[model samples]
Target: MVTVKAVVAGSFGGPEVLALVDAPDPVAGAGEVVVTVEASGVGYVDIMARRGEYGPLSVPGFTPGVEIAGVVTEVGEGVDGGWLGRRVFSQVQGGGYAQKVLVGADSLATVPEGVGAGEAVAIGVNGLVARIGLERAGVGRGDSVVVRGARGGIGLMAVQQAAALGAEVTAVVSRGRPDDRLEEFGASRVVPSAEAGASAEYDVVLDTVGGAEVGAWVSRLRPNGRFVLCGAAGGAPDTAFGEALLENYHKSPTFIAFSLGSLPGPAIVPQAQVLFEAAAAGRLRGVVQEVLPLAQAHQAHRLVEGGGLFGKVVLTP
Candidate 1:
């Protein structure tokens, strides 16, 4: 009957519906480890989950959070005893908003020395998403890539990763701070949402902001290019499928959708390990705009929904 503090949703609604509640402490089941969370990332999907927009996978009154970084406090049966007391990060299935969380052993990535918990949490979701999207898009040295929503957590990571990979990045940002931060993230060019229509074509387009903008940019891909759709921050619009088809008929540019949830548990840890190494080598960096205690989970959600933060928001307990 051990208990822990967690943010819970009694109903599917807005950020206000999140409440601090006492819940039974999580324990490591077989092949799992119980962690004392030092930080949990607050992502766009968390907001969508709170509103019940994710459909079948959604649950009511569940603790919401997808990524956490902390120290392993206990190991379940059949797990390696060496994992005990190690600091790690996980791409959790859910329940990361609590002070303690259970994580599958297969999904754990050791946090490197000198990497803070907040940055590890950021790398857990947003970092992995960027890595997968860029790899899928086949971006390489001297390739030109376009990134929509370039100021967001994932988008900024994409910009930095693309640059580190030797690709020229064109960042499409909203009218204000987003534009400025995109440049800071190493985008070679920055364009406002309105002007993206006339920008130079790219070898690949990493679109985090889907909507009419997606349809517009799909037409901007060069011959044999790729377009990776990773988020819907710009709003999901009815895509002009016919137009998209017509625009790429000759080049045969590919369109791929990406979600970290689609990956197998075992695959994520290795991918996260690569990102951690990149961050440790200074080839990748995570921006964490704010870190608040678990009691401020509601406020953190509000800030995320309102937008304009230059980095990831994290909750700690």
Candidate 2:
């Protein structure tokens, strides 16, 4: 077995539970490829899995990264050798935090021209979610939109995509001095969360923040407005549906909870191709705020868990 290094989590706890350990290298099975991982992504979901909040999604003694980008180092029996040196990015069923990973051949996609592994992964799943979420929300020209957590990995790209779609966009941030960069990302205005209370005059609200605060944002939606609740960075909100919510806003505002988990699995990678095109053309982007060594996963986890990071935090394995 080829020996390689990976971040393995032995138990559910804080960042301290992550350990960089030597492990047997992966081998590609039929229709699979072994990638020498150049970058792995850390997101709120990775943090949730580490804390045991995902319940049964992960077990002790598992590696913990949800996305990866790399060069194909090996391919399985039926796979073509031409794939051997292709740079690729893919979302995996866990095990992304390693020097090498085995992925289904069909799941692999070439990195767009001129995009590095770190930047590719920074915009990988997170940007794809934003792209898809906006499409699912029917975001269109002349729509007024509000995106909570606007300076985040998902928010950064969401703001860009929404603006490109011709929506008037307002980005909501939680802290620090007002970021002039939000405008650069196509945000028409930046609203700090403290000031966001009850100010919702939006036609569509793409809320990544969940929890007790959701209603305040929802309250501002104009009649028949749509609010897409896709994240729980503050914590998952209390869920309600049907009549009670529809009656509150007079014109039947729509509340949709956007969860990739609830959808069929096969739909993810193919939809991500649109993101590749968007990024390739410079219409979509995400920031890679930091690239830490694989051994420093615990520190990376700590940073992602603490929140308010301005961009994606990637680990080079």
Candidate 3:
């Protein structure tokens, strides 16, 4: 029987739970295509899922990856033959941490001709999350924006994208980190987290690290300012805190908590198209900090948990 290699979480707990193992080959159903995974994305969500902190959707002992870049190797019945051998980026529910994955035909986005597999995965999920979050926040020219966790995958992209839109971005990051790139990424100001909420005035705040710290920023937002909570790298706040935030910050401030997964699959293609065009035009900067072999996934997870990485970590199978 055909088989493939994947990183399986044998049990939920820590990075040690991940193990590279052989599994049965997956076949494409109708309207799906099987892809040979060239690059699989490793992100915060993977770590959360592996620790059983991702709630009901992500079960233990499952392959965990949300996006991948690869070439189509086989097409299911009713799939277009032209897709064979074509390079594509796929958004999957899970199971992307394998040598081969079955992808929905419509969920596939053509990787730009000059883009490498790892780069595609970088701009695929992280890029879209940043772009869509900024869009939902209604960022515009001359708007003051603060991107929490600016060193992260999505935050880095969002900082640059917001700057490209003429918004003045302030990147909030940990102290003593490699932050010299914030200016290059179009950030006008870089504030350490210890002193972030002191400024207390911004048109928008795109937050990746959520918790009581995120709630503290509520008082910093100006009237009608938008606070977009796109991730909870520090653990999410509970409903009581959320309600209290709204009640205390009654200046008509808007709190938007969303994920890229909540959007429809077809919305992905168009958004991916825009990101690819931006990168091609040099409007957006690189997101991939490094790419490692798939076997090093456990190490990658450890690095992510340590929270010192400069950008997205990808695994090549």
Candidate 4:
């Protein structure tokens, strides 16, 4: 019998709950492919899922990873044979922590020739989030944008993506976080989170760290500015506070709570390819802070939860 090594959350609580276990190998279903996972991203959402903070979806025995880059080993009945042995990356509901994963054929994006598996995983998930969020906000050339949580994976990609789209970017990172890569990634200016409100008015505010500060950032928007919330790592804001922020009709502010999962899978597959090609060409950067073995997934979780990392943490199988 074939077995695959995976990190399973024995119980939802902390990093210690993540345990490496050997499970039966997965086989491809119709229209699916089994990939040998070369690298898997450790994201903030994985942390929430592992801690049981993602509501009913965070059940025990779940593997807590969402994105992976690898090579296809087997193709399901309806899949094209050419996909087998191809380098690819995909985003899934879960199961990315395994050495091998079953992926939908339509969800696979070919990794560009120059990009490594770790880089592909970093650029795959977060790049799509940044690109889609910026698109939703109608951000364009000459638009002034502020990216909160700019040091994180999605935020870093947002800075690069916005700049590539010609929007001037102001990255808002908490105090003491690294500012070195911000400008290199296309941020025109970097501001401490505490001082971001007073820094400047922006046509678009792509916020990833939502907390009590949501209201404050919304208040800083230029009239008719768009505020896109792609994540809430800082915690959700109070409803009354949110209501208060919306009461000012004169600002004509547009507020959007964005989730990539809400969109159809096929719609995003092409976008993933665009990012992979851009990264391969050096037009976009894939920031990976560290790569650890699958057995050390607990350590990866701890690093992600502790914060202060400039990029993504990836686990290799």
By lDDT, the best candidate is: 4
lDDT of 1 by residue, 74-188 (tens): 9999999999989999987778999999889988999888788999987779988988999998889999998887878998889998998999998877666335557777898
Q: TM-score of the candidate numbered 2?
A: 0.94
Instruction: Estimate TM-scores for all models.
Output: 0.95, 0.94, 0.95, 0.97
- Candidate 4 structure quality by residue, lDDT tens digits, 213-240: 7877787888999999998788886565
> Model 2, which residues run further than 4 Å from truth?
239-249, 262-266
lDDT of 2 by residue, 146-167 (tens): 9999878888878998999999
- Alpha-carbon deviation at 148 in model 1, angstroms: 0.7
lDDT of 3 by residue, 1-317 (tens): 98999999988888888889999998989999999999999999888888887763367779989999999999999999999999989888888889999988988888777777888888888889989999999999999999999998888898999999999999999656448888899999887888764756888989988877776776678889998999888887655656646675668888898798887667788899788777777777667887888788898898888886678899998
Runs in model 3 lying further than 4 Å from the true structure:
238-240, 243-250
Worst ten-residue run, lDDT, model 2?
A: 238-247
lDDT minimum window of 10 residues, candidate 1: 174-183
User: Sort by lDDT, best first: what order?
Assistant: 4, 1, 3, 2
Q: Whose TM-score is greatest here?
A: 4
lDDT of 1 at 208: 83
- Score candidate 2 by lDDT: 0.84
The lowest-lDDT stretch of 10 consecutive residues in candidate 4 is 237-246
